[model samples]
Target chain A: MIEAQTLTKRYGAKTAVDSISFTVQPGKVTGFLGPNGAGKSTTMRMIMGLDNPSGGQVIVNGRPYAKHKAPLHEVGALLDAKAVHTKRSAYNHLRAMAATHGIPNSRVNEVIELTGLGAVAKKRVAGFSLGMGQRLGIAVALLGDPQTVIFDEPVNGLDPEGVQWVRHLARDLAAEGRTVFLSSHLMSEMALTADHLIVIGRGRIIADAPIQDIIDGQSKARVRVRADRPQDLLGPLAGDGVSSQVLEPELLEITGVDPRRIAETALRTGVLVYELTPLQLSLEDAYMQLTQAEVEYQSHSLSPTAPDTTQLTIPVEGRRP
Target chain B: MSAQTTTSPSPTRHAPRPSSGITFSRVLRSEWIKVTTVRSTVILIASTVLVMVGLALLGAWGYAQLAQSINDGSLPADLQAQGPGSPAVDALTTPSSGLIFGQLLIASLAVVLIASEWATGMIRSTMVAVPGRTPALLAKTVVVAAVAFLVGLLSALVSYLIAQPILGSQDLDFALTEDGVLASIINTGTFLALVAVISMSLGILLRNTAGGVVTAVGIFFVLPVIMQLLSGLADWVTDAARFLPGEAGNKMVAVTASEGALTQLQGGLVMGAWALAFLAAALIVTKKRDV
Candidate 1:
């Protein structure tokens, strides 16, 4: 288990990680989700005792990481894929790391085989592709057989197959009762792999709950309707918490109301409803809704100077004067 | 894709935690592995020994030729008048004559060993394994200093044996039993070991290979030259320069102390003090700063 109490980190005038408190439980996969530079990496580094926290402290398995007599046995972290010396062969690199804790070379070779690095285990890491580097990083993390495993952007440069492998590996480790805390910027990936998520934005905890709760909480029911007159149905649907967007002259997408209600309104308005489909909000959409305002490096859409005003309209409740 | 080969090993459920952990000896072993695994470290060590021994042979040859000239009375009267100290007695210092270059190579090697970890981002892995930070740094220093001492000791011993034949040609050969000769040879190792500690401390402080190398060269090479150029300016300049690490360490390997110069014990203490000071600062800074 990892517990951070008011952990904070500040670089000069910029606060990279605000005072945040959370706990990572064992026996499940906990995903740390954040956008770029949102302090996910910094938080992980702090947990590993690589960076000193500014005001608070983080402890792994009941003590600060450095205080443990056997730190490697308590927590193993792959903070960065390129953390190995490039001049050393992958086999030697793992051996060197294993030596600190007196971990046997047999375990080193075991990790090498488990990570599928046997083919190039003797080759220098300088020649490794990014995917191969990630594999080596994973191998290093697994060498100690720690109770808690932390991976930061483990699939950054992996292929689809490698990505799937990491997902399975994470789940398998958690199934074995190890604390698995993985970080990623992609929420869709978390949706598939994470049992619980702790989302951060701008150095603050935006959400900390089970994955399903976050999806269900932020995603209201949205429906698509094809009618003879979209504006007629939209006018009757205009009320508190109801928003509608006219897609075309006769089609509209409405939120905060179910499809059956939309059909009832369309029928009462004497508007013919040809297509009425209830749209399920993807996790990506829910993630966007959670982080849209907090995105530090928000990119403006292309052609911002000239928008197609006719094609889009604000919800009736949020329309400007 | 090779991902198909990535199989999950059944993690031994509740395997008894191994009793071994990050002890100083284990950290030393880890650091030794790190030092020897890099090909360049082996090459540098080998070259240091070779250059030191090679330079001693050259010095022996030069001293032999000078003695031959004095014997034939072919030298100018003024050149010959400098007396026994010129070639015969000076042969005792030949075993360590390569120290001038040996220290340079050893200093560079020590700096590269520590600084390259930061350059290649390997320090993270190192710090993660030994998060207390001091043990890892201390172990690396011990390993590096031990290697340097062996390099210096072996170089001097080999030089002493190899130079004997050449020195004997001029009747200038000496025994290890000669007063201070054995000490000088062994001190050659002591001197390089001190150089290694100081350079590795610089590596830890700077955390940049190029910057560490430059700073080490400045301390050991350029500072003495600058001191010499300014020694004529004042008596204090000359007096204060004697305490510089390079000046003091040079005296440690001397066959005989010059008039008003530091003795071997004094020189070793001064240089050792400097090494300790630098290493202490490095450890304190590293403990406080983020990796």
Candidate 2:
């Protein structure tokens, strides 16, 4: 398990990782999610003891990484795919690293075959493609048979087959009761691979929860209602714990009230209700709703108008959940 | 849907053992493997030996030819003895003939040995394995110094053997068993070791191969010349120049007192101080900097 408390890093005047705390538990895959420049890499570096944190501390398996007796066996990290000398061949590179821990040569060959790098194990890394490089990086990360593995952007340059292979590798490793922490900006990949998600924005934790909870906790749910007097119903519906907006001349988007309650109210008030549709939110829409206000870099092409929060009704053909 | 569950038999025995503690010998072995496996390191070692032997042979041949020409009346004897300490010059010539260039080459090799890791982003991997950092640096220093010392000694020996025949042909006796010859060879080897250590320290400090090499060369070559040209400004400057690493190391080999200069022990101490200071600075900087 990896635990970080109040970790922070500052470069000159700018802060890269502002006092963030999180823990990565064993027996499952924890996904570190963030936009570009959101302190994911900096945090990983601190955990590896590569960069000194300006404040706070990070512990791996109850001890600082540098203080561990056998750091390689305790934690294996692939911080960057190209953190290798291009002149050295893959086999020699692994051999050199293996020599440090007195690890046997047989284990090096095992990782080679396991990562499907057998063909290019003898070739120089300079001649390998980006996908090949990622494979080698994974091979090195598994060199010591470490219990806790960290991979940053492991699938950035992989082909589709390689991508599937990495996903399976991560899952299998986690199934063996190891701590698997990976970071990526691809939400779709995270949705597929990560059992838990820690989302950060602008150097701060925006959300930390289970994948299902993150999907369920977003505030984008709404019930769409259509009536002949939608304008007249807006004032009465705009109260505490209930909000209604006019989508069209006859359509009203209502929040904080279920479709059955809206229908009953309309029936009791003698309002002609033609349509009542409940919208189920997608993860993408939830993510947008949560991060739309927290996004730090905005493109010039975005118009001055805010995002449309009003719900539009589609013709009801079936009952909604 | 029914949840299908499939299970495999448990292991008959316990799981594998976790890795044991890290040993210093393992770190040393790792560093040795790293230094010896690189192609550039192999080439540098070979070239250091080659250049030293080649230069020694050339210098020996030239000296022999000059001595013969003077003996045969082809040149003036008074003119040969016109320079002070001509016998001392001829006696000490072959041992230190390859000293200047050999030290430069080996120093450059040492610089690259440490600096290339940083330049290629390999230091991260290295330090991850041995996080203490100082042990790795010390291991490299020991390896580089041993290789350079052996190379320097072998080159001087070869030069002595080759020069022995030429001197015999000229009816001039230059003895390898002589006191001065032995001292000179041992001193030359020690000098090369010092130069290698200095270069390795520069490598650690600069962390750039080219910058480290150039800085080492400037300290050994350019600084002394500049000091000599500005001797009129202050006599202490020239006195200080004698204590420079290269000059001080040469003084140890020649076993001759510099006129109104530091004693032999003082020279040795000066060279040792240089080595200690550079290594210390390199260690401190490495400890503080991010790998």
Candidate 3:
């Protein structure tokens, strides 16, 4: 288990990570969700004892990471994809890291094969593509057979197949009762792989809950009603708790009420309903709602009030709404 | 309940793995692996030896020719009367003729070893592997110093062996047991080791390969020249210039007594002081700064 209590990091006047606290328990994949420059990498570095925290502390398995006798075996982290020396071959880089922990060469070869880096293990890392670099990083992270694994933006530059491989790797590692904490800007990916999420925005924790709660709480449930006289039911549905907006002459977008109640109201009001579509909000939409104001950099054309309906291209099956 | 328990283990089970203690020997092994794996390190050590031997051969031949000219009565008697000191000078010069050049190469190699990690973003991985910064830094320092000391010692030995034949033909054989000859060799090795330590400290302070190399070269080369030029114009400046590290190191390398300078032991102490100051600064910077 990895626990961070009121952890914070500030660089000059800019606060990279605010006072945030969360625990990553074993046996599940916990996704750290944030946009670019939202302190995901900084937090991971602090946990690995790479960067000194400005305040608070992080503990891995009940002790601070630096205090661990065998840090590599206790908690392995892939904080950056290409942290290895570019001039050194992949195999040599892993060999040096493994030498630190006295981990056997067989384990290094096993991880290399496991990450599909067998072909390029002897080749210099400078020649490897970004995807291959990510594989090497994962191979190093798994070098010591660590109990707690932390990967920051693991699938940033992966192909579709590589992306699936990482997703499955994270899930399988979690299934083995290890603490799997991964960070990614890809909400759809998180929604698929993460059993729980800790969302951060502008260096502050915006939401920390189970995936289902975030989806239900932040995203509004809307029902599309199509009828001959969509305007007729607008008055009854437009009450204190109910809101209805006309999308077209025959279609009404109704919120603040479930589809069942809307359907019952339509039946009692003698409305000829042809279409009753309940819009299931994707995790992306929910994430946008939770982090709209907290986004550090806004594109010129992006409006804060605009609804987020952009399709998320996740490679996993069974998680798409 | 018994059947359920027999079917599967409890899902809430927690098994904490045993801790593996950090060993200094393991850290040393890691540092050794890290330093030897790089091609730059091998090239630098090779170049140091080659330069040392090449300069020794050149110095030996030049000295032999000079002695022959004096013996043949072609040169003035004043040159011969400079006396026994000449052979000491000749023997001392051969072993360290390439030192000025070789020291820079080895020092730059040391700088790159420490500074390039920060430049290439590899220090993050290193620090993660060894969180206690002192052990890592000490391991790196020890490794670099050991390699440097070996290179310096081997180079001096090779230079002495190569010069032996030429000096023999000139009727002036250098006894390895001579106080000046042995002092020069041992002092050269110590000086080279000192230079490597200073370079490693500079590397940690700057954390940029180019900056560290430039600063090291500037201190060893540029500063002494500037101090010399200034001393020639003023008497007080000449007195102050004696305390500079390069000047002190030059005095430390001399096989015979020189006019107006600190004793060899004092010069060594001055060099040691410089190394200690640089090391202290580096340790503080490294300990306080983020990787």
Candidate 4:
């Protein structure tokens, strides 16, 4: 298992990872989700002991990574695909790493064939394609057969088959009761592959729960309600935690509060309710909404006409939980 | 200590064995693999030897020609090429003379040994495998120093043997048993190895290919020339110049001591001190900064 307690990393005035705590349990895949620059890489680096945490600590198998005499055996991490020297052949690179742990060359060749790098194992990594590089990185991570494996953007630049292979690999690793934590910005992929999710935004944990619960919580029984008097009903219907938005002159979309409550509120306030349609959001929509307020490098498109663009004029209210 | 293994019905298909501890000797082995596996390392090492021996041959040839002219009584009557010392030994020293330039090439190998890891982003893998950062670096030092020393030794032996016959024909007094002759040849190798260690320290401390190479060159090549020029202007400059790492190392190969200069042992100590200081700085940087 991998556990991080109030782990933090700050560079000058900018905080890459804020004090955040979470646990990655074995027997399931935990997808670490974040927008770009959401501290995913920094957190992974700290976990690998490649970077010192500004505060708190992340432990793999109940100890800091460096404390383990054979860290590669305790935990395997593929933080970056470019970690291998470009000039070294993939076979030689793996052998060199294996040598440190007294691992034999035969195991190195096994991982090579397992990762399907046999054909190019002798070729220098400088010539490998992006997918091939990812394969090599995966090979390195699997070399020691650690109880916990962490990969950062493993599927980035992978082909469709390669992506499916990684998904299966992660599930298989977890199925064997290994703690598997992998990061990705692709929500659809996470939806398909992850059993649990730890979502981060602006260096803080936005959500950490089972995948279904997060989707349910974010897309919580949203219903479209049509009323003749939105302004009159807006205040009376706006109970604690209930978010209601007027879609048109006679249209209202409501979430957080159930449909029955919205109907009763409209009836009690003498606001005529015409239509109510419940809305279910996909994981993509859920993630976008969850991180809407938290993205650090929020892109402001020149096409202001695009609907659903977040407001640039006013400060976003307290971020949604 | 081994990681706590919880048997929770792991479905993992890959077979995993108990992890062996990371001993310094294994780290040395790993580092040796890292050094020898790369094509650049092999090429650079070969080049270092070639340059050293190649230049020695040229230097020996030049000396042989002058000696020949003296033997033939061709030069001015007052000019003497091989007066007393073994002209053969002098010729044997010619090939190693190229080591003056060959040291840079060897130093380049050392610089790339550490710096290229940073440049190519391999340090992450290397550090993760051996998290005791100091051991990881020291391992590299041991392997590179051995390789450099071997190259230095090979170059000295080849140049001395090849130039031996040429100088012997001229009736120059030169033999391995001669006082200081064998020591000079061995010291030449030691000097080359020390250059590599110092260059590697610079590579780790600087962590940039061009920066490390340039700094090593400045210290070993440029600084000595600058010191020589400054010596004429001040006596203290001479003292300081002799103490400089490159100049001090030069004394290690000197057959005869110049008055008011450090002995070979003192020179070796000074060069060793420079390597250690740079290594300590590299370690400090490794500890203070994120990889």
How many times do residue backbones clash in model 2?
Answer: 0
Fnat of each prediction?
0.60, 0.35, 0.40, 0.67
Off by over 4 Å in 4: A226-241, A260-275, A305-321, B1-19, B76-92
Tens-place lDDT per residue, model 2, B1-291, is 001111221212212245544577777677777767777778888887778778877776776677767667787767766765443356456766788898889889899888988887788777776677787788778888888888888888777776677666665546666656777787677788889999999999999999999999998888888898998899888878888998888776664564776655666678878998999999998987777
Model 1's CAPRI class is acceptable
Q: Scored by CA lDDT, what does every candidate get?
A: 0.89, 0.78, 0.81, 0.83
Q: Cα miss at A229, model 2 (Å)?
A: 5.4
Consecutive 10-residue window with the lowest summed lDDT within model 3 chain A = A309-318
How many angstroms is the interface RMSD of candidate 2? 4.6
Query: How do the candidates rank by lDDT, highest first?
Result: 1, 4, 3, 2
* lDDT tens digits, residue span A119-201, model 3: 99999888989999999999988887888999999998899999999988988777777788999998988977888899999
- Better model by TM-score: candidate 1 vs candidate 2: 1
Worst 10 residues of 4 chain B by lDDT: B1-10
DockQ of each: 0.48, 0.36, 0.41, 0.48
Fnat of candidate 2, please?
0.35
DockQ of 4: 0.48
Model 3 TM-score (2 dp): 0.91
Q: What is the lDDT of residue A61 in candidate 4?
A: 86
Candidate 1: which pairs clash? none
Q: Which TM-score values does chain B get in all models?
A: 0.93, 0.88, 0.88, 0.88
